[model samples]
Target: MEFKPDWEQAVRRFEAWYAFEETDRPVMIVSAPKAPRQDPPAPGDLLRRWTDAEYLIARHEAAFRSTHYAGESYPHCWPNLGPGIAGAYAGCEPVFDETTMWLKPLDRPLSGIHPVWDEDNHWWQVTLELTHAAAEAGEGRWVTGITDLGGVTDILAGMRHSDRLCIEMLEEPEEILRVRDGLLEIWKRAYSALADITQPVNGGTTGWLGAFSVHRTYPLQCDFCCMIGPEMFERFVLPELRELCRWLDRSVYHLDGPGAVKHLDALLGIRELNAIQWVQGAGQAPTIEWADLLKRILDAGKSVFAYASPQEVRPLLERLGARGVALAVGASTPEEADYLVRMSAEWSRP
Candidate 1:
């Protein structure tokens, strides 16, 4: 590992975390900027900013050069075309804005909507090009991750708007399955294709979540499940998630927000699902607010990961007891990163 000289040690730590065991300390990923960050004026075209391969690669390279990755943290460059890029690959219209990008909804009946994988889709090509360029620049320095092709049902919700998909799931349940079945195929094809490109260069694989593994692993998700009940979730989302978990060597479900907690039990039921990344979402800052929830996931027999602050790490470890707990956090200085790594041994349960 070029950027990570101590990668083998980190791998040992990660393996313990995945198996619900503690190494010398619970896994804590910490990073600090090598120097203070400054901003330059932005270009007017959001589309070019998102699509330009050289620009994207150089930007990641700059960040890699400017950040001190410590503890379990490592340099990872993931193609972030927002979460709905999968819908774009299925030929859905994309609307670019200043902060993010989204797919323009079709909002038509399921019977009329037939989504297929377009091998030559514009955004699809952009994502591939971006991955290749990032890998070239980051080959020995940083790791390149596959783009977020997104979860199948979420792609359907993006393709047909969440409101319309909610209606279709009830009024035309079978048709809902019909369309999602198609999207599921597209999801597999897209993931497999990107994995083929990333694996050889990355020496394994990583995702937007920054969790790295020597074998195939992904942060599986279906944010749309927050809209439906358990019955609907099990019917529409669970089967696809099961297939993904079975297919991949390892997986962690990205359980985001209050709305998503409802599906936790259903997700936990998947035998192959390795862990859960619990996000407290907006206004839920200072992750310690969710100690009970974090403990619940650990009790359910899966390793847990969350974003916390340096201040929250010790208390979180205290409350959760650190057995299967991992926290990804930011520090302000190289000294702070070193401090956290040393203090984590104190934070972990004996």
Candidate 2:
């Protein structure tokens, strides 16, 4: 809260945004480069860049300190080993890349492999090491978020390959559900493990969605849901998602693109879900143009978050109102960041 004079005020905005309640303005996360930008030399090897805890923490701290975290944006680091990391924790080997890690599928059916948390999995260890280092470095200086533990259905797809999982679901529905249920337990255990380290250090929680929570909060998602229809989603995905939402104090569904929007009605019906992060996907349209879809989510009484350019923020807020919307907007200067904060109040509606 020491980032600005009104830091506590910004926290209040986030709390209101989470509850879909009235506030002075919508919560916006805006960050701009420091006046004199600094860039460190790139690490030589991609593997070391990811697994080297010291290097990862240094980079996180550099970015955390150099940028101006405006609006609801603040210093937080999640040990991202890609979104499918839970698959690796369950025994699938991960092929590394600069941007994300790919979880290699099983050569045979996953009927034999029981999903459980491997405390000694290399990537899991990397996650813990990186998180521990970041937590120590950021103890009183910043808020460090939990790792992306991932969704159960997505982990199943990652382990068995999406197409193979589809066939397995049709051929052996009960076994597939059993494995999914096991993965759900691992997911819950992973969260509790990470929370044990993160919560007392900062007295709050956050996840890859870049939102803050006073207690347990997450951006729950199932990217594989896009490949399946509503019936399959209800049978395989919905039960676990519903259970997660019920267990967590705050939860947001990550609804991605037109493909997954088919499940929007079902997602909106979940009384425990607190919000939605609508990722409209690339090469389609600016999120500002999707007012009707966003308003539909809002009308369903769930808070929503979306992306916008700085120029789009005003009209976006004007159309959507200030009640239950949060946006991630980019700024190039401190003045522009300040302007967006003011515009939030100016454009807010009843």
Candidate 3:
């Protein structure tokens, strides 16, 4: 079945901000806690729901319906298995359950290190199949694609343990490059396949009567390189990141946590990067603590994705000009969402 997208306006608006173009209004979203959903749906369930007119409503609200243990508490239906799905085809096996997925090593500290590319690999096959399922299920919903994978270091760390990866940097430097380059090839290939999948709906591609033209965009991510310092990131992660960025229309770095903040210099310096999704970590002062970081990102001439309390909305607007900030707030109903949207729009403009 042909992939379909019902939120072209939302997509274009997001792409515009992702590309750092000044938009007419900021995308003010109501970021709410997942009010317990009964019989939480999977990708297949979503597809089934999308086919039914009533189900489409549920599919559209899939984000709020999904549950996650940790990390970006967004919808789980996006199917972000890992960047090493391609690498898995080369010998790695991915483990998937109801909640999340991860790649499993073949043997002791990297035994089955084969440079193969088979769609039959556990991770690769599952993702490929899910793409079809989503295309079918997403009949008239939001687009579905894998997360924008970071370069080799990121993939390896994910496939292999971080401690093992640190050892590999010394013990198996050559293998590291082989794995890195191999994963790069695979990352690009997987994304290209997804690109083909979303092309009918303009998923990873750009161009929609906008003032700014994005050479490449969609499949947004930057989870890798954020954990390490700038030096480590430069030597191990940046090269592949550069490669990934060159392929997309507008690439935004998902700067996750204060640990990843060290790479902020490298991220801001990269010309190809369009914006930064500052994922403020949990605990006290999350939305408020990152005020300076937001300013720095803006100073670097990039956009930001932030979530604030409804009460904090006024101060947030006063502090950060809304030219490039996308708000994810929690509103009770469409009326409330509309009110906040209008308020944000008014504050953001002048």
Each model's lDDT: 0.83, 0.85, 0.58
Tens-digit lDDT track of model 2 for 1-350: 33344556666778788899987788989988874645466679988877776776677767766788888888777778788687788888888888888789888765797887778887778778878887877777778888878888998898888998998999999999999998998888888888888888867788988788877898999999989999999999999999999999999999989899999999999999999998889898888878889999999999999988898898898898989999998898878987897778889765
Model 2 lDDT-worst window of ten:
1-10
RMSD of each: 1.7, 1.5, 6.3
Q: How accurate is candidate 3 locally (lDDT)?
A: 0.58
Which ranges in model 1 have alpha carbons more than 4 Å from their true place?
Answer: 38-44
Query: Model 2 Cα displacement at 348 (Å)?
Result: 1.7
Say which candidate scores most in lDDT: 2
Per-candidate TM-scores read 0.95, 0.96, 0.77
- Error in Å for residue 302 of model 2: 0.2
lDDT of 3 by residue, 1-350 (tens): 11222244555566667656776666564533335555435446532332333343355455434322111112223444444445455566656554444667545545456455666666566566656665555544444444434445655776777767877776777777777777777767777776567556434443111112223554334455555556667776777777767777676666777778878888788787777777767763767667888888988888887777777766676677677777677655545555666677666666
Error of 2 at 8 (Å): 3.1
lDDT tens string, model 1, 256-304?
A: 9999998888888888888999998887756998989898988988999
lDDT of 1 at 129: 91
TM-score of 2: 0.96
> Which candidate number has the best TM-score?
2
Q: Count the backbone clashes (under 3 Å) in each candidate.
A: 0, 0, 10
